[model samples]
Target: MKLLLDENLSWRMVNKLGVVFPEVVHVTSLNISQPASDISIWDFAKKNGYTIVSKDDDFEKIVLLRKAPPKLLFLKTYNLNTEKLVNLIIANNIKIKEFINSDENDIFEIFGE
Candidate 1:
């Protein structure tokens, strides 16, 4: 599944995982750095068929309410650097993708562990 990563995540994380997740993209790269509201981001994700991979719980709430192509994966913890975050994703890729594909209507949370 394609992922629309939030600006809260470092761009380098997307760069490093480019090979692993070929379609991973950041909001900055989408030229959405002009401070659009969260609703705008949700609209963008909905129109683009991209699931929201964000550090924001609002996205999770949006998914819980709206329920569709705008699926969410909310990263709960803070203070993680790019490398650690990359490792966490890599370690969990298969299971994560399986779950993502298994249910696009579900909202998921990933905590640093």
Candidate 2:
């Protein structure tokens, strides 16, 4: 599945993660300017079928409160470092796939080691 990285993620992380996530795009990559509103981004993803990968808790609310698609990878980890985040994604990718396929919606929160 593809990952649409949020504005919170550095654009460099997309390149750095390489094959970990098949396709990862930052908001800037989409040519959207900075300070894009949460709802707008979510709306874009919903309309376009891009599952979100973000550090923001707002997506969780969107999932729980709004039940939007495709689902969300909510990085709650505090490290906020590139390598750490990449490792978490690599480790949890299988679970992520299950989330995308199963009937239930998911919230994947990475706790920093």
Candidate 3:
């Protein structure tokens, strides 16, 4: 599954995650206007078949109201650097993939253990 990473995440993650998630992209790369709104990102994800991966709970709220198609991965880990964040994702890769494939859930939350 492709990930449309939110602006909250470092754009550097795009390349770092590229090997594992080739289609992963950051909001900055999309040429979205500065301070892109959550709605706009949601629209882009809905149109592009990209799941929104973010630290923002707003997207989670959106998923709760809108239902599927633009799924969400909500990273709830605390005070992690970009590398640590990426590592966390790698560690939970299997769960993320399973969540993407499942039809029952729209939002997947990842927390540091």
Candidate 4:
């Protein structure tokens, strides 16, 4: 599954997460406007088949309101360094895969401890 990393996340994560999520990309790398709006990113992901990866709760609210074409992976944590954040995602790789593949669920949350 393709993943669109939100601007809140570091662009460097695109390379770090590439080991497992080969199709991952950060918003800055795209042609879209700098500091893209959540709606714009949502629309872009829907059009391009990218599942959004973000720490923002706005996406969850959007998904609840609009339903999903572009799935969401919500990172439910705060104050984590990029390395730890990357590790959190990497550690939950299998669950993420299952989440992407499942049709019953559109939002998968990964909590950091």
Go through the candidates in order and give each one's C-alpha lDDT.
0.77, 0.76, 0.90, 0.93
lDDT leader: 4
Q: lDDT tens string, model 2, 14-112? A: 876657666677777674556777787888777877788888887788788888585788888876578788878888888877776676655666666
* Model 3 CA deviation exceeding 4 Å by range: none
Local error of candidate 4 at residue 14 (angstroms): 0.7
lDDT of 4 by residue, 68-107 (tens): 9889999987888899999999999999999899899989
Q: Among all windows of ten consecutive residues in candidate 1, which has the lowest summed lDDT? A: 28-37
Please list the Cα RMSD from the true structure of every candidate, rounded to 1 decimal place: 1.8, 1.7, 1.1, 0.8
TM-score of candidate 2 versus the correct structure, residues matched by position: 0.86
In order of appearance, the predictions have TM-scores of: 0.87, 0.86, 0.94, 0.97
Instruction: Give the clash count for each candidate.
Output: 0, 0, 0, 0
User: What would the per-residue lDDT of candidate 3 be over residues 14-84, giving only the tens digit for each residue?
Assistant: 88888788899999888677689999999999999998999999998899999888999999987799999
Best candidate, TM-score: 4
Residue 17, candidate 1: Cα error in Å is: 1.5
Q: List the candidates ranked by TM-score, beginning with the highest.
A: 4, 3, 1, 2
